[model samples]
Each structure stands twice: as structure tokens, then as C-alpha cells.
Target: MAAKDLSTMYGLSESDPEQKLINRAGMSASDLEQIDRIMAEMGRMRQIERRIMRSSQEFMKLNETDMRALRKIISAKHAGRSVTPGELSQYLGISSASVTKMIDRLEAHGHVLRTKHPTDRRSQCVEVTEETHLAARDQVGRHHAKRFEAASRLSSEERDVVIKFLAGTSDAMESSLGSPLDDDAR
Candidate 1:
């Protein structure tokens, strides 16, 4: 089989000057080339993330929001806490009614259960079913564990630098939205 062309998948190579922004004052071609390579890696990571999301959604038979809800519930469970519909609504930035509908859908699919609140008799708690939890752990959870391993392999200084770079990138994206993201939204 012919070798696949990565340039087409990853956009123009660093050697293509037209693909890069105007070079900053005092920056050499070498600097620009490095920046282009970094941006290309970022694009590759984004594409991989999209593929992973599609595969996870398909395998789990759930939409993005459903998967996010499940993740929140799993987090809460790990923290030794129970989640309520109201909490889910707040976390998801959706209306209570919408959260109720989502819960209904999840419950019907046997992914979650509505259990009586251990502390509050007036409210109920949401729990991930054992089967669903195990499945998620076996799939997405395992993937994330690999990510943790990769991050752990980085030196503390390297991790700090990565953290700062990612934060700056996130801030730039939020700024491009024409308004700052709210603290709660973050």
C-alpha cells in the first residue's frame, strides 16, 4: 500500500510560509518553524480528540451531553457523594426541566438509577449503574489512565510549562469568543 500523505491530513507543512502568520519582529525563520510545528501538533491532538469522542459516543450509545453527565456522576461517586438533578442542571448549565428530561432518558437506558437520598428524604440522588460504570471504566477510563501515565512521565518543570501553555491557549480561545468566559462556566 502507498504511504498515506500526512500533509493533507494535517494542513500545510511548516516549510510553507503562506500557511504561517506574519513573523513577529526580531523572530527568525527557525522560531517561526518551531511555532508552526507546535500548532500542527495541536491540530493533530484536536483531530484525535474528535475521533475519540465519536468512538466513545458510539460505543456507549450516548450523546456528548449524556457522556458528560455520566462523567460528572462518576466524579461525584468517586468523591463519595451523590448527585441530584438540580446539581446536574447547575453543572450542565441547563434548565431543571431539561435535566429532568436527560435523567429520564439516561434512566430508561439503564445507565443511571434514581436512588433515595441517604440524607435528604425530600430529594433523590442519581447513581451510575454498576454495569455502565464498569463499561465506562473499561473504555474511556482506561484511555484517560493512559493520558495520566503520559503526563506523569513528564518532569515537574515540564508539566508546569505545559500547564502554563495550555492555560494561555485556553485564554486566547476564550478571548476570541468576544467575551470572557464566566468563572462558573470554566
Candidate 2:
């Protein structure tokens, strides 16, 4: 097919830069459909995330920021890493001072511990206590299991499709916006 014909098939205007690239690459309708599906799935995932956040707030009695910080710290410890306030600040897109205050509160609650960094003499590391770990595991595990149980009414194929669709959506979004969970700096 001619470049113009292929671009028209993909619904790209002739003057669009993407249209020029697509014409050079010869994209398919299935590719366009896949992109559209991914975009739609992303919207659905955001709605699900919001609902989960709301449910967590109602059941856990913790604000979203606190819950997120706790979850991040727990995940870091589960991965065998000591989390730093700076890292949490970057991950949460908050100031380091705010992260320090949050850590202090968590420490007071006996949910976290602050210790000297393994290698850095000047920095301290935050770790979840065993008690906190167990509590977090039980709490989050049960909540998620219940959520999945409710979802289990769907057939296996339908569940697989949902998982794949969400995974693809997440990947596309992560590609567009850098992953907030990645610990690039300690």
C-alpha cells in the first residue's frame, strides 16, 4: 500500500509527524487497536487504584500518604533493603523533612526502626520491625485476598485477559512516566 493509504488506515492525518513515521514503518490496524485497548485499560486501572485507596483508607484508618509510605517501607524491607528518608521522599515526591517526620511517627508507633546506614556514616536507614512486618503482611494480604476472591467470579480466561490488559497498561504508563517505586538512590 502507498504511504498515504497506510497513514489513512491508521487514522493519522497526512501532515502529522507520527503519520510520516507510520508511513515509513507501515503500521497495522491491529497495532492501533492494541494501543487503543492499552489506553482504555489504563483508565480502568486508575479507577481501580482509586477504589482500592478509598477502601484501604476506610478499613485501615490511615491517610493515603501514610499508607503509601508504610507500604513502600514494607516492600523495601521485604526486598532486603534498608530504606532512607531521601529515597522515600523521592519516591513519594515529598520533601525529605516530611519523610523524616513521617518516619518519626511510624517509629513512635513501633512500626519502623531507624538505624545507622550500613556503609554511610552520615545517613540513617529505615526498616520495618518484625512486628510491623507481620502486621502489614496479615493486614494487606487478607485485604488483597478478599479483593481477589470477589474477582474470582470471573472465568479463568477473563481473569487472564484482565491481568494482561492491566499489565500492558502499566507498562505503557511506566514507559511514559518513570517508575516511582524504583530506588535509584539510597
**Each candidate: how many clashes?**
0, 0
Q: Estimate each model's TM-score.
A: 0.83, 0.56
| Tens-digit per-residue lDDT, 32-99, candidate 1 | 55665667677777788788878988998999889889999998999999999999888888899999
lDDT of 2 by residue, 1-186 (tens): 222212222233423456554453666777855554544454565577688777766655567777778788887777888888898898888998898888888788787899999999999988878876676667666767876896798899988988887677567767778754354222
RMSD of each: 4.2, 9.1
Question: Whole-model Cα lDDT per candidate?
Answer: 0.83, 0.71
Q: Tell me the deviation in Å of residue 42 in model 2.
A: 11
Give lDDT for model 1.
Answer: 0.83
